[model samples]
Every structure is written in C-alpha cells, then in structure tokens.
Target: MSRQGRPQDTRKVSGELFSLTYGALVAQLVRDYEKDEEVNQQLDKMGYNIGVRLIEDFFARSQQGRCHDFAQAADVLTKVGFKMFLGVVPTVANWSAKGDEFSLILDQNPLVDFVELPETHQGLLYSNIICGVIRGALEMVQLEVKVWFVQDQLRGSDSTEIRVKFLKKLEDAVPAGED
Candidate 1:
C-alpha cells in the first residue's frame, strides 16, 4: 500500500496520553467487573464499537479501495491500518497452509506501555482490544473473521502476537422495506 496521500498530522492524541487514557480505562474496568474475563469482554466490546467507527476514518484518510484477497488485506492492515492508528507496523507471519489464517507479531504494543498485569488478573488479555478492533474492521469490509491473542508480552511472552482467521464474507443486507 502506498502512503503517498496519507495525512501526516492526523494524530491528535500524543502517544503517552493515549496510552495513559487506555490504561485508566482498563483499570476502571478491572475494578467494575468481578471476573477478568468479563473485563476482557467489555474491552473487546468497546474496541468493536471503536473499530466500527474507526474504519470510516481509515477509509477517508487512507483513500484505499477494496482488498483483492485475504493476503492483501492482511498486508494492508499491518502496513497501513496499524501504522495509521498505533504508529507501529507489526510483522505478519505464521500463515496457515490454506491461507485463511495469519498472525501479527508486535514488538512494541502502545497499549501495554504503562501496563503490568497483576497476579490476580492473569486471565485478562491486556491487548484483546486489538483483536476486537481487527475483527470489527474486517467485518465492516464484508469479511467475517475470528481474531484473538495467542501470545501477549504481559503474559511473559517475548512478543505480542495476534492471530486472525478468516471465516466467510458476509452477504450484503438489504435496506429495511426496500426488498
């Protein structure tokens, strides 16, 4: 993907401020929810909402068209989407033989910059929001996918890895009363 016409000054929030804000949100969720799994679900749900909107901004700013294949979609996501949003581009690897699954390896995750999972919250996937974001964005573009974190830096992993599996393309929905 080309970055030729992409806006350079689109980032309104500083990296630290964004990270701190996210950290605070996660902490509050942890306090509000009794189980770590619930907190994770909430975070993913929040991210899904964000992604649903975020993709519109992505389209406007990126000026990109439809991806021809899953490989191209994965490449565009890691190269364009991640860089545009998180200021980082993860390496795409671990492709399944059928070309329906892949992993995104992040050497540095901004969300975890100031986060440390406590022993009591070991079940929490600190960066699960990312998975939701991916799933949501892809869904908006007609791709049904399963996204999850297979490895996390906070969970003693050397790197953060998110696995994405393509399920099926969604059929277009007709407008209400238009059929």
Candidate 2:
C-alpha cells in the first residue's frame, strides 16, 4: 500500500533479484578494479552512483501523482519510503509550520541491527547511501539540500536521525508552449 491519491508501482521485485543485482554489481567492480585496494574504493563510489539514479526513480515512481505540497511530500517520504526500503515506517514529528525543517525518526533500523562499528570507524554511518540519495534527489528539484544523520538522546545511541536542510527551493518557470 502507498500514500492516498498516489500512483503505485505494484511490480514486485523479490529479495533474490535484489541480491543478484548487487552480486552482479560487485562482480563488475572486482573486474574493473583488478585489485582489492581499488575494489573497496569503488564500492563506496558505486553507492554514490546508486544514490543518484535511485533518487530519480524515487521521485517519479513514488511522488509523481501525490500532492506536491511540502507537508504531504514529507509524509510520503517517511511513510512510503520507509516501509518499502527499510521495512519500518518512521514517525514524523516536530514538523515546522513553515515546512522548512523536519526530523526523520527511525524506530527500527535494518542496517544497524547486529552491526558494530570498528574502532577506526566508530562514527561510521550506515545509511550514507540515503544521504547521497537526498542530495541527488533535491538537486534535481532545484532544491539544494544538505542531509546528515543525527543521534537523538531518546532512542539512545542506536537511534538514527536524517536531518534535511533546504538550501534552496525549485522555482519552475512556465513554458511558452503551455501558454
């Protein structure tokens, strides 16, 4: 199920398919790297590229028919995106009336469960892919945004926060043919 008044893509791609896709990606990376050192660097680089392409489809596939209003957009982002991607829809709270600032509260994180960070990477963030996704997606809408994860006290150290700051909003100009 999706947001009310929203168009849905009901095509279900199974977990196996995703695994195959990821496997293929890693295989390609290994071939391209020709060495272990390059493979690690390329994996993170691939995450950025994945983030870029995912954002394009995320908007068109999820938000295309829904309300373009900021509040509604935030709702869809939290409710729909969380369920499909992470299997947990986060609680949306502390919304600014001006619609400029908001917080994403993740009660359950699929990425962090049973995960421990190494000493060299204690500040190691798991969902950096999402950060890149937000950056790429907002850039497309002409809204330059900075997105980062924050740890809130209430949920203890395991909690995750995605803070989005709108640097600019898109101003769509009318086309001549439309007039």
Candidate 3:
C-alpha cells in the first residue's frame, strides 16, 4: 500500500522551468541557424509567450478565479499570486485616481539573486517578464495596460516598485462599414 500520509508524486514542473529551459532552446536555435539578432528576438518572444500561458494558469488557480474589476485583480495579484509563486507579497504603493495606473511595491525579490545586468542591457532586471505577464493577463479581459519596473531595490534602495499604467480599454473592432 502507498504510504498513508505521504502526498502523491503530484508536484509538476512550474514556470521557473520555462525560464531555465528557454536558454537551451535558444542556444540550439542559434546553433542551427547562426543568427544572433534573430535569436535574441526569439528569446524575447518566448518570454512574452511564457507570460501569456502562465497568466492563464494563474487566473485559474486564484481564489476568485478571474476578476470582474481591475481593483480586485490588483489585490489578488499583489497578495495571493505573488506569495504563492514568488514568495513575496508586494504592497500597493499607489493607486491612481484615474483608475488606469497603479504600482506594486515589492520589498523583497527572490528571483533577482545572482542576477546582474550586462552592460549592454544595464537598464533591465529580467523581472520585467512578470510585468509582461501581468499586462498580458489583464489585457485578455479587455484592459489595455503598460507595466514596467519603476524602481529596483537591488540597485540599492529600501524597496522596489513596479508601476502598471492602464493606457485604455480595448474597444471591440467594429464590423465593416461600422468603423
């Protein structure tokens, strides 16, 4: 009989694996074709695709599932999702009155350890993947958004902040002659 109290082999590979496995895939793609810039673009596209798929799963696993409003969506993201996936719950640093801009203030980041930006790409921390994921998920529900890391505690600060700007609500395309 199986161990009475033991959990099953149910733990599966997670989003972290995508980040790790992508390197080898990109390397192989470059090795086969010998194109650097194209490979770089592919890597970025792969990262974006990762954002797209993972956000779907994220929403599915959330307590409220999909949110009907952006405020609740932000709360779920800042609280439960981050804690479960990244082990840190960011505070809502600011919420704009315009209802289109907000900030997630992360005091701790587990993913940034040993991460240093190359001189050519010094302005990035790679955590922007999370931003892209957030944007992609909300955009799917008709929220047009822009997300970026406005501050990095890793760069020597007491805290880090990610700013999410909602640009516009995506309007449904009109039929021919209606536009």
Candidate 4:
C-alpha cells in the first residue's frame, strides 16, 4: 500500500510502450488541430493538468517537504522529480547571475525515444508538455515559474534543453470573510 493507503502498481512500464503511447497522442493532436502552435498549447494544457495531480502523488511517494528556494526547487525537480517520473536525471546548468533562471539539459528524453518531427512540424514543440509539467508542479508548491524549451533534439539540436525562470512565490490567500 502507498502512503495514501492506495495500492501501487510496482510493475515496470516498458519505455517503448510509453514512447509509442505518447507519440500516438501527439499524432492525434496534430490531426485534430489546424496549427502546430495550437497543438503545442493543447499539449501544454494536458501536461499542466497532469502535473497538478502528479505533484500530489510525488509528495506521497517521495516523502519530500517544501523547497526553501528556487535553486533548491530546481535541483529537486531535476534530481528527484525527473528521475521518479521520466527515468532521466537532467543536468541543471546555465544559471543566470541573479540565480533566478537555469536550464535542464536532458541527456535522453524518454518521451522522444522513437519520435522524429516531420519537416512540416518544425515549429511544433514536441516536448512542450515537459515545460508545462514543470510550471504546473512549481505552481502547486506556491512557486510561480516560467518554463520553455530552449533547444530540442527533435528540432536538430545536439541536446534537449529546457529553460526555467523563477517568477515569484505565491502568497497564501486569506479566507474571504476573514480578510
């Protein structure tokens, strides 16, 4: 049983199965959307929804507490979060002098294990969902952040890099009647 008193599936998921499933979803989205930008937005939205829920599971499974700062948050996300979910630990690099921003260099993106972006879909961010996931997860922790794909292997980049910028921490809201 999991910490939440739920049964956990210990079965390991095949990487190929995961990749093919994601590919099919992207393909369907491309067919449904008229523009690549729209597809990217849709994918991000999907990831956001997933992230919102996934964070709860992450905490339950990992037994981690709140992050004290953006730098720590980035470290935990790359070291623990990515490893838990995607089976990859991205290298955190390219920090801004202000320490408000950094980049995650993914050596291998499992989501793109068997993906090849067609020439017509150059503008499409095939892994934009990752950005959304990071943004959504951070938001849940009261950390407002901006995430984007700076470079993509599918887009001919030598490596996959996701850039994250910390915006601000969200303040707790008072109840309407108590304020």
- Model 4 over residues 1-179: C-alpha lDDT tens digits? 34587566676687889999999999999999999999999988888877777888899989998788888988899889999999899999999999999999999889998788999999999999998888877778878889899999899999999999989888983222210
Clash-forming residue pairs, model 2? none
**Tens digits of per-residue lDDT for model 3 on 93-113?**
688997767899887765565
> Candidate 1 deviates by what RMSD?
5.9
State TM-scores per candidate.
Answer: 0.90, 0.60, 0.65, 0.90
lDDT of all predictions: 0.87, 0.58, 0.63, 0.87
Residue runs of model 4 more than 4 Å from their true location after superposition: 1-9, 173-179
What is the TM-score (0 to 1) of candidate 4? 0.90
Q: Kindly report which residue stretches of model 1 are placed more than 4 angstroms away from their true locations once superposed.
A: 1-10, 173-179
* Candidate 2 Cα lDDT to native: 0.58
lDDT of 3 at 94: 80
Candidate 2 has its poorest 10 consecutive residues by lDDT at 170-179
Indicate the worst ten consecutive residues by lDDT in candidate 4.
170-179
